[model samples]
Target: MDTNLSNYLKKEQDKLNELLSAYLSKLSMPPLLNHSTKYSIEAGGKRLRPILMKLTCEGLNGDSEKVYPAAMALEMIHTYSLIHDDLPAMDNDTYRRGMLTNHKKFDEATAILAGDGLLTNSFHVISNAACYSDTEKVFLISKLASASGLEGMVAGQLMDMQAEKESISVEQLEEIHQLKTGRLLTFSIVTGAYLAGADSMILQKMERFGNLIGLIFQIQDDILDVIGDSEIMGKASGSDEDNQKSTYPSLLGLNGAIEHKNRYVKQAKNLLEEMELNGTLLEKLVDYLGSRNQ
Candidate 1:
């Protein structure tokens, strides 16, 4: 990855932080509920989903400013998923983003409610994207909902839970991760295309690119869990091994996981280039993914 791309992602990430803070401040709920919700939403994360949404919009000739609300909504959904995933019944993690997991910091009930609030509130943010035409707003909202709901991330999570400690085929693992990790990513890119009124061909290409990157991202996470530092990863490392979860690195050898990640990264870059779209930022984003230390 280029050093310049890392610098640029840092700058773009700062803007995402500002947007998150501003949006969180505007939220209105009962004081206790609001505090619970804010606790996890404000916790630091890489904010990759929103960044991808904004960059995809920019790549397809849409205004990033106009797409910011939708982008932020994506982040909320992602964060909510993380909150829920860390519950004792799920991954049972105690740390996240270098801070206590919501359940650990607060309590399981509060963390559950916080996740619920964030999930419901995410739609409000997307619906507020009415600055665009009714059709565009409707399209984006529907797409995001599908990605976050049953047919997407939820399905993936269910599969993951069911497959824990069991041997799964390569195809099964891919299916699980694609749903668990790839669907929202697909929505992020497709939402940008809808807002920009891009043709079906462009949307299809972007979808392919997003799916490829999403899988690559998961594979990298699996690799990191095996080899990454706990401090840098902000979560327990080697938990996949301890939990006996089926992961790419578990199903494939460590070397195989590295090979798979490199292959997907190459495929993602090729798809982006084939789109012939001005994805300078998106290209940099993909390279950064390939090079991310954690």
Candidate 2:
């Protein structure tokens, strides 16, 4: 990874961490509820969605701070999804980010509630942030909800679970991920551009970039699950395979998957070049995604 990109991402991650901690601390809820919610959100990992949002804002010459709450909300949604995804009825994983899964660390009920708390609080945070207008807040909330609801990640998860009953095609797998993971990722980038008041052309380009990045991310994750170390991924390798879930490497061979990843990486680079906006950080980010070890 480029030192500059690493440093920049670290700085933003730190700020997001502090903000999340502060917000959670202010919750006047039961101790268990607060603790469980805090545990999952504070689980150590890359705050990728929020970082993408903030970067989009900066690349558009918009103040990233203006979008901080939206970024924070995005993280909350992501954290909530991870919590739910690890439940017994779901993937049933016991570890994440090298730590016990929320349900294992806490109880299942608490974990469920914690996921709900995070999900519900996300909209509140976005709508209640001080910097953006009520109109902007409404738009932000709508986008998040839509992307998170039946039309987006949840819909994708539903398809994924159903597909596990049998086998699925590569195109079906792609569609599942496009909803389950890609939509929100796309929302992060496009929302920043929308809030920044960028032109329609700019927003369209960002949508394309976000979609490709989302696919690249999922593909890399599948590749990692096959070849990655548990110590590095902080989860069991081959969980997808173990769960009988389809993935890029499963559908395409390992080498083929790597080739697919490379193609998207190239497309992302070309997209950035075409956009010609704040190229340095974005370029480094795309490169980092392609090359990161974990």
Candidate 3:
């Protein structure tokens, strides 16, 4: 990474971490629930979704502060998903971010409740945020619900599980990811740009950019699962194959998956160029995420 881009990313991530901590500290939940939830939150993943939101908003010259609450809510939803995704009933993973999985750290029941609390409280945080106008709050809440709920990540996860049971075409695979992993990621970009006062045309283009970036991110993730080191990844690598999940490399060869990701990267970078964001930190993020090792 360029020194400046690396510094910028670190600075934004630090701010986001503080905001996440502040929000969690303010919520009055049962002590155990609070600890379990905070444990996962502090485990320290890339914080990619929230960082993307902040960058997108600033990239459009918006007051990035206005998007902080929404960004916090977004990370909460993502963390909750990870907690559930690691459960015995789901991926049954034993680790995350280089530590014990939530279910392993706490109990299964507590992990479940912690995940539930995070998901539910995410909406509460957004709805109660005083920074947004009523119209803005409604927009954020509704869009978030659609993106993370039945029409989005939840539905995609279901399809992914179902795909594990049978063969699926590449087109089918794309549809599954577009829902499962892509929706929330897209939500990050779209909501940030929306709050930044992007015009309708730019919003449409940003939506497309977000979708392409989502695909790029997932494709790289699948690649990482194949070639990544468990220690660096903070999880067991090749667990996708062990779990019988359909991955890009499973459907397409490793080289083929790389080609596919490159195609999306090209399209995403071009979209940035069209939006006049080609030389911004957002553009650097596209390259970083495309080839990220962890």
lDDT per model vs. reference: 0.82, 0.88, 0.90
After superposition, which runs of candidate 3 have C-alpha atoms over 4 Å from their true positions?
none
TM-score of each: 0.94, 0.97, 0.97
**Candidate 2: regions farther than 4 A off:** none
State model 1's lDDT.
0.82
Model 2 lowest lDDT segment of ten: 275-284
Residue-wise C-alpha lDDT for candidate 2, range 175-219, written one tens digit per residue: 998998999999999987887788999889999999988888889
Task: Give one digit per residue, the lDDT tens place, for model 3 in 1-294.
Answer: 867778987887888888778888987888998899999998867888888898899999999888888988999999999999889988788878889999999999999999999999998888888999989999999989999998899998888878889988999999999998788988999999999999999899989998998899999999999999878777778888887777899989999999999999999999999889999989999999899888
lDDT of 1 by residue, 1-294 (tens): 577666766777788778777777887678777777778777757778777877788787787777788877888889889999999999888888888888888899988988888888788877776576777778877888888799999998988999996789989999998999899988888877766778898888888988998998888888889888988777778888998888888889999989988999888888887877535878888877876777
How large an RMSD does model 3 have? 1.1
Instruction: Flag clash pairs in model 1.
Output: none
Cα RMSD to native, each candidate?
A: 1.7, 1.2, 1.1
Residue 208, model 1, lDDT:
92
